[model samples]
Target chain A: MRSTVMYGAGDVRVENLPDPKLEQPTDALVRVVRACVCGSDLHPYHSMPAAEQGTQMGHEFIGVVEEVGSEVSLISRGDFVIAPFAYFDNTCEFCREGLTTSCEHGGFFSTAQSEAVRVPLADGTLVKAPVGDDSALLPSLLTLSDVLITGHHAAVMGQVGPGTSVTVIGDGAVGLLAVLAAKRLGAEQIVLMGRHQARTNLGREFGATDVVAERGEEGIAKVLELTGGKGTRAVLECVGYMNAYEMAIGTVRSGGIISRVGVPQYEEAPIGMGSLFGRNVRLAGGPGAQRSYIEELLPDVLEGRIEPGKVFDRTVALDATPEGYTAMDERTALKVLVRP
Target chain B: MRSTVMYGAGDVRVENLPDPKLEQPTDALVRVVRACVCGSDLHPYHSMPAAEQGTQMGHEFIGVVEEVGSEVSLISRGDFVIAPFAYFDNTCEFCREGLTTSCEHGGFFSTAQSEAVRVPLADGTLVKAPVGDDSALLPSLLTLSDVLITGHHAAVMGQVGPGTSVTVIGDGAVGLLAVLAAKRLGAEQIVLMGRHQARTNLGREFGATDVVAERGEEGIAKVLELTGGKGTRAVLECVGYMNAYEMAIGTVRSGGIISRVGVPQYEEAPIGMGSLFGRNVRLAGGPGAQRSYIEELLPDVLEGRIEPGKVFDRTVALDATPEGYTAMDERTALKVLVRP
Candidate 1:
């Protein structure tokens, strides 16, 4: 079997590795049908230290159940499934609260970029996709494993609903999806704050009613101006950069909310009196915990009501995985769909 | 008229000053019946630089409407009114959205400690009290301007409601009132975290279901211990110190909320991926914006259903305002009420 590995910063490789087999009673063997490079994967690709033993790559994937252990009941061999970015036991207290990322017996997946991988807690971690593995909706269905649901998480956390006015920061795949999510949730005003014309164009198609091609203070002023000197009720921060967070604080209207799905790249932020407190703004959002969100958003992708997979502007075969990482890193590809 | 002034850190004095007069058509003159020192006031008293012309102090007060300008419509002379800490026209966009603190024409009141104050935006800043100026309910009604409603703000922002579990940090006036407010909102489990026995005892009276007299790590551990190893769903942070905010992040459950009504004294905080993001926790709250909350909470105070005034353990004449600040600064008093 061939799998993706990261040896150090800027080094992504596809190498032959021993095929995986179900080890636990609840485990299942999945043959990867589709996977992709995530924005977060670029984090380590930029600064990770060199090591003799590189780390396995990828967490988002849609696969077919090739084999299942004795305890796997809900899932069976030959079933098409979508695995959430994180593996969790659905019965855990946190999972019951729709917070699967914090499930008591849960952890993230790291072997999704391979031809075949062992999925733990199969009954809970894998959701049966409504469509077959070869369906045209496969790309969109794969996104429900993370980004699509994550975008929804931002909207849910920010309490974006009917009549909500929202400002989405960052033009990344997640940000663009958030625009779509906010629109699906009935947001009346969707302003995309991004300087990237190519990405912002997709954001516009994703239902962004307005686009602000400015950054920093100017971007905040434009967002405020766009909303009649009062920023949107919700600011979805999909970029983890401190400058984007600062803009989130600056543009959130009094008593509004800032929902961040971006994994923070910085340790500290100005979240005290002068920023969040004085204006009564709220700071919301976190790791997507798509395990609970997949079922809810899967229907949209299956029925072709939405096409979140538009984010994957390029695709790569197993042997070309290295080039895929480089293309994404250099911004030549929005997101790269991987085939094994 | 006598007024309280702070020349610098730890320096407070009450001196005779010219009586106030209306300068705007929306202004009204009010005789101060009662004023109180707040926990937030201690912030400036701890580090403000000295000035030749000392800053006039105080923002919370209840008084008789001595006179009204020709434009004042809702309020008239001889009416007992409760003035919110901030003054606003109440007709602005933000005000209509229930964000009175961000009113376009709003500003905080600083002459509340004086014998008389010229209140701007009288029709919007003042809410007529159901009880007379001399009634015992005055103490509780006075709290509606800040503490009591501020406490309610914490609960409301945290989404505390029937069957909700919450933890109230700090046992100061606002913290104690928060326990009362959470109780009023029907929180199922209320944990009051504070080391001060006197204040914690008052918290118990206000319906705190559990008391954790621990600080820092021990406090966070104790709270987790009480909530079955997962922190409470809502952490109402009433303490402005950074340490308290840290505990807020530590004690919030996965996907829980940290509602901070404290005027955060610090500038930076660890609110990125490692803290709020990883757990899917939401940070909500800000300046109490009681202008919108006062009316909703007034009936509880007027009907003797709750006694938020028990937080005011000490009283002083206007001439002894300086001593009041000392007593509060040294933790000798929970809160001090002043009479003119």
Candidate 2:
């Protein structure tokens, strides 16, 4: 088996690795069908001093179950499944409450951009795809494992629904997908905030009613102007930076919600009493409970109701996964899909 | 007319002041029936710079309408009314969304510990009590103007409802009332965190299922222990201090909400990504939308179902208002009710 490994900053390699096998009674062996590079992956790709041991990479993948341990009852061998970014024993109290990401027995995936991987808590972590071996739907299904469902989490947490006017900040794959999620939730107006013409064009296609090309203060002003001086009813903060969070705060109307799904990078962000308190703004959303949303969103992808896979602007063989990283890092590609 | 005035740090004086009159077409002049010194008032009471002109003190009051401008249609002379701590023109978009504290035309009350007050937006800001001249209910109705309603806002914002478990940080008047509010909302378990035995006693009386007297890390650990190590589903952060906020963050379960009605004093509270993002905890609530809750809560107060006024541990004449401040500041009283 071949797997992606990060030796250090700017050093990604696809090397032959020992094949994974089920170790626990609840574990299952999955042959990877599709995988992708995440925006957060860039953090370690740019500078990860802790990766001195050549760490296994990738947490997003969809595959076919090749083997299952004795305790795996919900899913069987040869079943097409989506491995949500986090593995969780869906029977836990947290999982029962729809917070699978916080399940009592939960852990993140690693070395998923490989030929085969061992999935723990298989019964709870794997959501069988409705269709069987549909190569064209692979990208979209893979997205449900992380980004698309993450966008859905933002929309749900922000309470974006029928007649809501939403402003989505960031032009990354997650932001674009949030636009689609908000649209699916029946938002009346969806504004995508992105400066790049190419990304904004894709945003328009994803149901953004308007696109503001400004950044920071000007971007907030543009969003406020677009919403007639009062900011949007819901703001999806898809970027985790301080400025992006500030813009989300500034672009949401009094009493509106700011749903942040991006993996936040700041240790201390200014939460001025005068800002959040006076306006009664709500802050919700974090690491998406992707497993909670995968089942709900899987049908949409299988039925072709939404094509979130369009975010994958490039696709490469598993052996060439390193180029995929460079392509995204150099801004030549929006996202890279990996086929193992 | 006479009013309580803050001349400087530790200097509170009751002095003769000019009578207030309706200054705007939408204004109404009310003769105060009851007023109370709030916990927050101590912030300026203990360290106000020399105020040469002597600023008028007090923001919590219930009164009888003595005069009304031509435009004041909802309230008239002889009607008893509760003026929310923050006056708002109920016609604004924010007000329509039940966030009157953020109304486009809204302002905080000042100099309310007086014989008369000129209330702006009278028709929208004043809620006429169901009964007239009921001095026994005066204290509870007065609380509707601020503290009690603020606590109610905390419960409402935290989404405390039937069968929910809640942890309330702070044993101040607002925190005590939050316990009552949580009970009214049918919360199954209410934990009140405070070190003062006297205050915690009142908290238990107000429906606290448990009391954790520890502060900081110990307090959070106690709460986690009480909730079986998973933390509570709802947290009411009634203290504005940074440590209280941190404890609230640490004591909320995954996907739980932290409703903060305390006028947060910190400009930059540490909202580390490691804390909020991974657990998916939500932060909501602000300067209690008091006006929004007054109408809905008035019936309960009028029907003698809830006695939030019990929080007032002492009462003082208008001339002895300074003693009221002293009583509260020295911890001799939970709250002080002032009769002008």
Candidate 3:
């Protein structure tokens, strides 16, 4: 098996690695059909502290079951499935509450970047598709493992619904997908705040009604003006930067909701309690429970009701995995799908 | 007319000032029957901002409408009313959304700790009680002017409901009143984290099932333990301090609500967004829209179904305004009602 690993900053390499084998009775082996580099993965690729020795890259994928452990009853060999970024025991109280990302025994599946990978709690974690001989939508379905679900989570947490106007605070694949999610939920308007042409166009294709290139106060002002001075009913913050958080806060109306999906890169953000309280804005969001949205949305993708795969501006072969990381990091691609 | 003026940080003088003649068509003159020193009033009293020139004190009061402007038709002379902490034109879109306090033309009632005061937007801002002789419940009704309604707002924002376990993070009158609000909403369990005997006693009397005397981590631990390690379903942060915010964050369950009513005194409180996001906690709260909750709860007070005024342990004449401030500041009184 071959997997991509980063030895240091900007040092992505694909090389032969030992094939993953089931270590627990609840685990099943899957041969990766598609995978992609995530923005969160870029954090370590650009920074040294998070880069561990021999650490495998990637946490999103769709695959076919290669083998199964004794206890894995739901998943069998040759089954097509979507694996979420995080693994959870579906029977846990937290999982029952649909916060699978925070499950007590939850762990991430970064090592699944390789050709063949072991998935823990396989029966509970993998959502198998009934389709056969259909894998072209794998890239978009792979997105269900992280970005798409996360965007959907942001919209859901913000209570995006009919007649609601939403502001998406980033233009990454997740942010673009958030526009899709908000639109699907019947939002009357969706505003994307970013500068990249590819994702910006993809944002429009996915349902963003407007785009604001300005940063900070000016951007917030635009959103406010667009919302008729009351600010948007819902705001999806996909960038974890302080400025991004502040802009989200500034653009949301009093009693509005700010569903932030950005992983905070900084230790502190300007979430003024007094201002938030005075404005009566509700901050609701978390890591997307991908499994929660994947099943419902996968069918739409299969039926071509949504063209989420348009977000993948570039595609590469498995051996060109390093190029995918480079392209995404340099802003050359919104997302790069790798087909093995 | 007499008005209460903040001559200095520690000096609150009740003296004859020029009678307030209506300046706006939306204004009305009211003779105050009762008013109280609020926690916010103590802010300037403790540390006067250099720019806070000789401003009138108090923002909470229950009064009798003595005169009405040509524009004030809903409220007429001799109507006993509950004047919200702020005046608002209820026809505004913001008011229509139930955020009366954030109304575009909303104005706070100044000179509230006085004999006669001018209330702006009288018709929309004042809610009259059906009973003209409900003076016995005036103190509780006065609580509805600010503290009681603010407490209810916190409960409402936090989504506190039957079967919900509530944790109140302050011992002030608002915090104690919040426990009552939670109880009224049928919260199965109420935990009040405050040490004041008067407040704790009021909390218990108002259906607080548990009282936590511990301050920071200890208080949070007790709440988490009490909730079987899941944390409270709703947390009302009544104390507007950094420590109180931290405690509120630490003591809420995943998907729980933290309704903060505390005026954030510090500009830079380290809100751990990581924990907030990871746990999927809903941060819903702000300076309460007191006007929104007063009408519904006033009937309960008038019927003796609830006694919010019991939290006021002391009373003083209007002339002894300074003493009332001193008593509350010195912790000698849980809350002081001043008769004008």
Candidate 4:
């Protein structure tokens, strides 16, 4: 099998590797059908500490179940399934409460940007694709594994609903999808905060009612001005930087909520009482409970109610995965889908 | 008229003052029946900077309306009323949304520890007492102006309700009242975190199911142990110190809420992503929207369903207002009620 490996910063390679096999009673062997480079993957690609050897990369993938261990019950061999970014034993107390991302028995995808991979907790992790081998729906189904569901998580956490106004921060794939998610949830106004004209255009297409090109204080002022100096009812914090967090907090109304999905990078963010307490702003969201959301959103993608897969602006063969990294790093592509 | 004034740190005096007059068409002059020194009042009382003249003190009071301007409609002359800690024009958009503390035209109580006060926005700021001149209910009705309502705000903001477990992180007057509020809201289990045995005893009487005297890491461990290692579903942050904030954050389960009514004193509180995002903990609350809550809780107080006024352990006449401050400062009194 051929797999993508990251040796160090700026060093990605495609190399032949031993095929994965079912190991645990709950494990299943999956043959990769579709995979994508996630925004979070770039975090390690750009500055991860050097390693003595290459590490398997990719946590977002759709695949066909090649074989299943004895304990696997929910899925079977030859079934097309989406492997949510993280595998969880969905029966845990946390999973029961819809927090599968924090499941007691959960692990991230490993060696998934490859021809074959072993999925642990198979029964709980694999969501069978509603349609059989629909190549055109592959990108959309692949997104369900991570980014689309993540955007939906942000919207849910932000309490976006009918008649409410929402502000989405960032223009990355997830942010754009968040606009779509907020729209799907019936938000009356969706404000997308992105500086780039091209991405903001896509955001408009995805249902942004307004776009603010400014950043930092200027961006907050613009948002406040647009919302009658009250700020939006809900803010989607799709970027994890400190400034982005600050802006999300500043761009929300007195009783608004700020939902964050981007993996935060700060170790010590200041949460002043004068700001959060006085304004009654709520902050919530983390890694998406993709497994919990996948089933809920799968029918929408299958029915063409939402086309979140459009975020994949480029697609490449398994051998060109390294170029996918460079394209996204250079801002030349919004997202890169990989066919194995 | 006589009023209590703060000349400087450790200096409080009762001095004669001219009677207040209704200045605005919406203003009303009230003869104070009862007032109290608050935990927050102690903030300035302990170390307020020296000044050329004394500053008016007190924000919690219940009084009889002596005269009303032409525009004052909700309250009138001879009506006993409870003045919320903060006065606001109830017609504002914020006030309509039940956030009176953030009303467009809102001001905190000043010079309220006096025989007479000029109440601005009288129609919106005053809630007519259900019964006239019920001296036994004075303490309870007075609490609705601030402390009791503040505690209820913490419970409501924390999303406490039937069957949920809550932890109240203080044993002061507000904290004890928070326990009462949580119980009234149907919380199944209430944990009060305080070291003082007397205060914790009051907490128990107020419906605290458990009292954990430990602080910091030990406190967190105790709470986690109490809740089967899952932490409580809601936490009432009644103490504003950084340690209490940290404990509140640490004592809540993933997706739980921390409602804070304590006026936070720290300029910079650490909110690491590792703690907030990873756990999906929510932080909510500010100064209580007292006016919004007063009307709802007033009936309970008036009907004797709740007796929040029991928090006042000492009483002093207008001339001995300094002793009221000293009793609270010396930890000899949970609360001090002043009769002018």
Candidate 5:
């Protein structure tokens, strides 16, 4: 098997490795059909501590069931499936409550960039995709494993619903999709904050009614100006950068919500009376429980009601997966898809 | 007119001040019938800097509407009214959205400790309480001016609803009232964390089903153990201490909510992936929009469905207002009622 590994910051390589085998009766062997480089991957590309043994990379992928462990009941060999970024037994109390990432028996994915990988808790972690392995919708289906569902999570946490307005920070794939999710959930106004022309243009197509290219105070001012000085009712923070967090804080109206789906890189955020409390703002969002969300979002993707795959601006072959990391890290690609 | 003032840390004095008169066309002159020393008032009592001219004190009161400015339409002179801790014109955008504390023209009250005070934005800030200023329900009606409504805000913002379980931190007047609010909202299990026997006893009467006297890790361990190691669906932080915030972080289950109505004395709280984000926990709550909540909660207080006045365990005359502050600052009383 050829898998992705990170040796240090900016050092990504794809090399041959021993094939994975089912280590648990609840595991299933997945031969990946599609994988992608995530913006979070860029975090390590910029500053991952050196690891001599190298860390296995990738957590999002769409694959076909190559083999199923004896106890795996819901998944079968040759079935097309998408595994959420984390593996969780869907029946656990946390999972049942839609907090699947906190599943007692769950852990995250690290080998999904490989040609084939072992998925644990197969029946609970892998949701059967209603398509053939070579379907054209694979790119969109692939996003369900992470990004798209995370965008949905941000919208949901922000309580985006009919007749509300929203401010989306960051033009990353997740941010753009958050605009889509908010629009789908019936938000009347979607203001996307980003400096990227191409991405903001796409954001416009996806449902952004306004775009603020300014940064920092200017950005906050622009959003506030657009919102009649009240900011938006919901601010979706899709970039974990401190400035983005600050912008979210500045652009959230009193009693509004700031939902963060991007993994926060900073530890301390001002939550005092001067920041959130004075405005009566709520803070929500986290790593998406995609195992719970994948099913809910699949029908829309399958019916082509949403075109989330448009986020993948570049694609590469498995051996050239290293380029996918570099392209995203250098901002040369919005998102990079990899085919084995 | 006698009024309370804070000259320095731990220094409180009651002295003569000129009676207030309407300063705005939207203002109302009110004669204070009842006011109370609040937990928050103690914050300044413990850390106020010495000044040649002491700061005016008190923000919670039920008063007789002695006079109304020409523009005051909703409230009439001689009507009993309750003023929230903050004054706001409720027709403002923020107020219309139920965020009265963040109203564009809003400001805090500082002269409620005086014999008479001028309340601005009378039509929006003062709600008629359906009783005379001398009614026996004065204490409970006064609680609606701040504490009880704030407790309701904590519960409401934490999303306390039918059959939900909650862990309320602190056993202050607000904390005990939060237990009552949670029970009123149909919370099936109410776990209160506090060591004060008297306060916790009142909490029990107010619907606290379980009480944990432990603090810190042991407290977290106790709460987790009680919730089968999952914590409760909500943790109401009624104490603004950092440790109370920490307990909130520790006891909130995955995807649960930690609502803080207590004004956080600290500026930064851990909201990184390791704290709130990893658990997918949402943070909600603020000073509370009591002007908006007062009307809704008034019926319960007026109908005897709740006895929020039970929190006021001591009383002081106009000249003895200083004693009220002293009693609350020393924790000799859960809350102190001041008559002027």
Candidate 6:
């Protein structure tokens, strides 16, 4: 089985890894249909995370169930499913409360991002999709495994509503998808802040009414100006950078919401407590509890109401997974979808 | 008119000042029946604010409407009323949205310690009592002008609910009333962290199930331990100190609500963004819209379902306003009510 492994900074390689066998009654073996590079992946790519040699890469994917243990009743062999980024026993009190990402038994699917990944708590963590010959859309659906769900979480947590003025910081795939999510949630004004014309165009297509190429204070000013000086009613902080955090605070109106989906790359987010308090801003968004929003959003995607898969600017074979990682790392691709 | 004035740090005096006349059509004259010292007053008392000699100071009071301008129709002369700490024109967009404290035309009453005060937006800023001659309860009702309302705001903003566990930080009148507020809101478990035996007793009377004498990390740990290591579902931060802010965070469960009413004495609140995000805490609360809660809560108090005014542990004559401020500042008083 081939899997993506990181040997050092800026070094991702496809290597033959041993196939995974069910070690627990709750586990299911997933033959990778599609997977993608994530923004968090860039952390190690840029030498930001601890340098661990030969670590498993990637945490987002859609796959076909190749085998399932007796305890996995809902899903079976040949079922196509989107695996939530976090493995969780959905029956837990926290999971029942729609915080599946914080499930008490939650763990990440972290064996060398292989062809056959073993998913724990399979019955609760895998959401089977309607079987189809739709190979092309698999990459996009695989995105549901992370970015799309994350984007939707950002919007839902922020309480984005009809006529809400939404400001999205970070033009990465997740940020672009957040624009789509806000649009799906009925936001009237959508502003995307990023320099790349292609990604910003995707954001525009997804319902971004305005785009600011500037960064930091200038970007905040642009958002405020676009909002007629009142600032945005909701801000989606998609880049976990200090600048994005400050912009999220600066651009949100008093009593507004800031939903942050970006994985924190810094030790602290540069949020001013005084400003957050005085403005009465509500900061929300955590590791996306995909189960919370997936059911609600999946039907819309399946019906073509939203095209979240458009975030995939490039797709490659599983053998070229390393190249896919490099494309996204070098900023040549918004998102790279890899098919096994 | 006699008013309270701050001559310098630790120098609050009762002195004769020029009476206020109608400056706007929305203004009215109120002969203050009762006024009180507030936690915010301590800021100026400690000379933390821009020092101005002989600055007028008070923002909380209950009184009789002695005169009303032609435009003020809701309130009539001789009506006993609770004047909001911040006067707001109820007709404005912000006020219409129920955010009266952030009203565009709002002004905080600051005649310092005053026998008579001019209240702007009388029609919108004052909540009249249903009955007269409740003078014995006026001291408690006076607290409605600020502290009680702030406590209610904390409960409302924190979304305290039936069966929810709540923690309150700060033992000021507001904090004690927050215990009452949480109880009224149906929180089954209430923890109060504070000093002063009187305030703690008042909190217990108000339905506090636990009291933590320790401050900072120890207090937070005590609260978490009391809640079986998961922390409270709702936290009311009544003290505007950095330590109080941190304790509020430390004592709440993931996805808990933190309603903070403390006006930060320092320019910034020391909150780590990572902790806030990781814990999924929703932070809210500030200057409360007293008018909003007074009407809803008056019936409860009238019915003896709650007696927030019981928090007034001492009373003083208008001539002794100086003593009231000194007592509260020196920690000799939990709360003092001033009578004219």
TM-score of chain B of each: 0.98, 0.97, 0.96, 0.98, 0.98, 0.95
lDDT of 5 by residue, B214-332 (tens): 99999999999899988999999999989999999999988999999988999799999999998899999988856668888889999999999999999989788888887887788
Best-performing candidate as measured by DockQ: 1
Docking class of 1: high
lDDT of 3 by residue, A1-340 (tens): 9888878878888889888888999999999888888888888888855345757788888889989999999889999988988898888988887888878888888875679789999987999986653567766777788888999999999999998989999999889999999999999889999988777888998899999988989998888888888889899999877888889888898889989898877655555654576788888887876567887888888887887777787889888988998998989888888766
Q: Give the per-residue lDDT digits (tens) of candidate 5, residues A1-340.
A: 9999999998999989999999999999999999999999999888988888888889999999999999999999989998899999989888888888999999999888899989999999999977998799999998898889999999999999998999999999999999999999999999999999999999999999999999899999999999898899899999998889999999998899999998999988999999998778999999996566788889999999998999999999988999999898888999999998
Best by lDDT: 5
Q: Which parts of model 3 are misplaced by more than 4 Å?
A: A50-52, B49-53
Query: Mind giving the per-residue lDDT tens digits that candidate 2 earns over B1-340?
Result: 9999998889999999889877899999999988889998998887799968899998988889999999988898999899888899989888888788888888999989888899999998999886666568888888898999999999999999999999999999999999999999999999999989999998998899999998888889999999999899999999888888899888998899999988787867766577777788888988885566888888899899999989998999888999999999999999999988
- Once fitted onto the true fold, the runs of candidate 6 whose alpha carbons sit more than 4 angstroms away are A49-52, A267-273, B49-52, B266-274
Model 5 spans > 4 angstroms off: none
* lDDT of candidates 1 onward, in order: 0.90, 0.89, 0.85, 0.89, 0.91, 0.82
Name the runs in model 2 displaced over 4 angstroms: A50-52, B132-134
Cα shift from native, residue B271, model 5 (Å): 0.5
List TM-scores for all candidates, in order: 0.98, 0.98, 0.97, 0.97, 0.98, 0.95
DockQ of each: 0.87, 0.79, 0.60, 0.65, 0.86, 0.42
DockQ of 4: 0.65
How much is the lDDT of residue A266 in candidate 2? 86
Per-residue error for A284 in candidate 1, Å, reads 0.8
TM-score of 6: 0.95
Worst 10 residues of 4 chain B by lDDT: B267-276
Query: Which tens-of-lDDT digit does each residue in B1-340 have in candidate 6?
Result: 8888887888777788899888888889988888888878888788744456678878888778889998999999989988878888888866887778668788678873688888888898998986564565676677678888889888998988899899999889889989998999899999999977778987998999999999888888888889988888899988887778789878988888878887755444433445666656677776786577888887877676777888777888878888888888888888888777
Task: Report the C-alpha lDDT of model 3 over B50-122, residue by residue, as the tens digit.
Answer: 4555778888888888888998899989999888888899988888888897889896777798888898888
Candidate 4: clashing pairs of residues? none
Model 2 DockQ reads 0.79
True contacts kept of each: 0.94, 0.84, 0.61, 0.62, 0.84, 0.28
What lDDT tens digits, residue by residue, belong to model 2 across residues A97-159? Answer: 888889889999987988988999999999998666767888888889888999999999999
Q: Report RMSD for candidate 4.
A: 1.5
Worst 10 residues of 6 chain A by lDDT: A264-273
Complex DockQ, candidate 6 = 0.42
